[model samples]
Target: MSQAVTLWIPGLLDALRVKEAQASLKDLKLPALQTLLAKADKFAVKPQSFYEQASFLFHQPGCLPIAVTKASAELDEFNPNHFWLSVDPVQMIPDRDTLVLVPGKALQITEQESKALLQKFNAHFAEDKVELIWASSQHWYLSIVQPVDIQTTDIEKLAYQSVNAFYPKGNAAQYWRQLLNETQMLFYTHPVNEARREQGWPEINSVWVWGEGKIEADKLLIRTDASIHSNHAYLQGMANLTQSHYCAEPESYQAWLNQIAGFSDPGNGEIDKHFICLDSVADKLDNLQLDEWLTLLQQLEENWFAPLLQALKRDEIDSLLLDLGQEYRAHLKPSHLNRFWRFKKPLNSL
Candidate 1:
């Protein structure tokens, strides 16, 4: 119970830039966040994407490896004891200049289509002891008899980007690359793609395998008193392993408040810590949805920032922590709110 609340908001700078462009900061009602920012201590850290930042919170390099396939397996109700890797179905669009791979999340992929595709993968790779499991149309898992040492990039990270640059890296990079290339060719003329084409659906041309690792016993070593709440599978897995309370994502800030309104005070006399993940902006950015991203920022100002600011003023929370991904985090205590003389700058100023 070292913290009263930790507000996890990704793409703060991008949101800020959009907000500032659409309207002036003074026009927005975010006094709590603004005041805290004006007075809170700030530091620079390494730049990382939302997934990278989230991954580091629970798993230390080597201590708590990110068994993404296993975590995703739990979501799919698939067995987690086997060695696995994430293999997302994607559509590769060839351009006159370059070829881009659009993530499956952006396409309309059905469960039946996924099952058929996975069957094909399993049949083709059966001799190699590699099998593909359809967790969902967007999430697929690859099970192998032996572990793969190659590190691959997240599919979301490569969405709408060139696939040529995403060749696996590490000891077994060549084998993985060859396997992936072969699979793409195998899927190119699959009956599923033909059926999808007839039905006007995007083709499942390739798969991106990444987050390869086994679930380590020490994956939950970073124990914290903070309660975990998120809609993400990985966070839920982390919470389950850490034995912390896990709540589904709230549709509104009011819903979230209702869920944690009665949090019991730790007997150690420390304030209860609440960790929240609000990632709509990041998701929008990945999908190139600028308008939706801007709208979400406006809603955040009205729902989250305004309400949390009022909560702090009422002394319901001891402090606020904003994780803007990477090394950019703001720690704001109630006392900081009183620093009226401190200059309030826009988010991009930092």
Candidate 2:
């Protein structure tokens, strides 16, 4: 048994951030939530950075920490088998519940057997935490049991502890292999729309529970190009956090830009935009000499991002410009960057 393992636990309630459009949540208390996020900065996203209720997860006695997330949220009507998998120890695992961690399980175990198995484990060691881990159920028989290494970091090494009855193996390896091949093929220049991609029954992507020992997803491959521009608050926050937390000797925000700017989309891409909360980088913005921000944006458009994308990616990080309104644009030069919109709120003295 391993002694120490680093399980990714969603932070406590005070750490997460939750955000919504002001009008969408008029009845809700936002200041208190923002205060909570201000302290933790717990969870983040690509388009925005905010916390989620999942941050306060506390697993029950026997439940496993696993979740089924849809491959794409836009898809209508979720079929159990169409989704991706993520491990969230605090939320996924409930006490007395067993978590089966597999990529795409196709088989569903019988209810009676599943219940019996649950009773069996809970009868003696109900207080202990365990997992039924596997890659794919190709060559194995039905059902499995084993002691788990809670301290294991590498998921592959922490295989199942006990083995149950074996069954006739299927062409699962071939199936998974084909799935991976198809996924890559679908994303090329001539992308296939989801409606036309199905060959079988559901005609949709779905997640499933196999009878133990099944691989869930194919390898994930998304490349961040060498040169690009624009702002994605989530990515920005992640990059900032990475620099602050991982890099021993700290570097400037500009340096982060210079380095990440080297990567851009290989395909022709459009300019992306994002915003950073003023408070997060307040100190850094105080010192400005000779329009340094504009200088960086222009450089990125010409030599850095444009060439890489075979098009261009423009970024607008002018938080100052955001508040200045149209008055600044009137006297400014033609190239003063007029891409902005402002909305003023009325007094809240109701």
Task: Assess each prediction's global lDDT (C-alpha) against the native.
Answer: 0.68, 0.23
lDDT of 2 by residue, 1-350 (tens): 00110111111111111121223233333232222122221223222112111111111122122222211121233233322232211101112444232321222323342333333323433343322222222111112233112211222222231111211124443443343233223322121213223433111121122222211323211212111111322223222322211111113334434443422434523222211122222223334332453343244334322332221112222111121111111111112233233221211100
Per-residue alpha-carbon lDDT of model 1 for 230-266, expressed as tens digits? Answer: 7777767666655566677665668877776555545
Runs with alpha carbons beyond 4 Å of true place in candidate 1: 1-3, 15-29, 56-82, 95-99, 144-146, 222-224, 261-271, 285-298, 324-327, 343-350
Number of the top candidate by lDDT?
Answer: 1
Steric clash count of candidate 2: 48
In Å, residue 102's CA in model 2 sits off its true spot by: 24
What CA root-mean-square deviation does each model show from the true structure?
Answer: 3.9, 22.3
Q: Top TM-score: which candidate number?
A: 1
The superposed Cα distance between candidate 1 and the true structure at residue 108, in angstroms, equals 1.0
- Residue 278 of candidate 1: its Cα lDDT? 64
Task: Return the TM-score for each candidate structure.
Answer: 0.82, 0.20
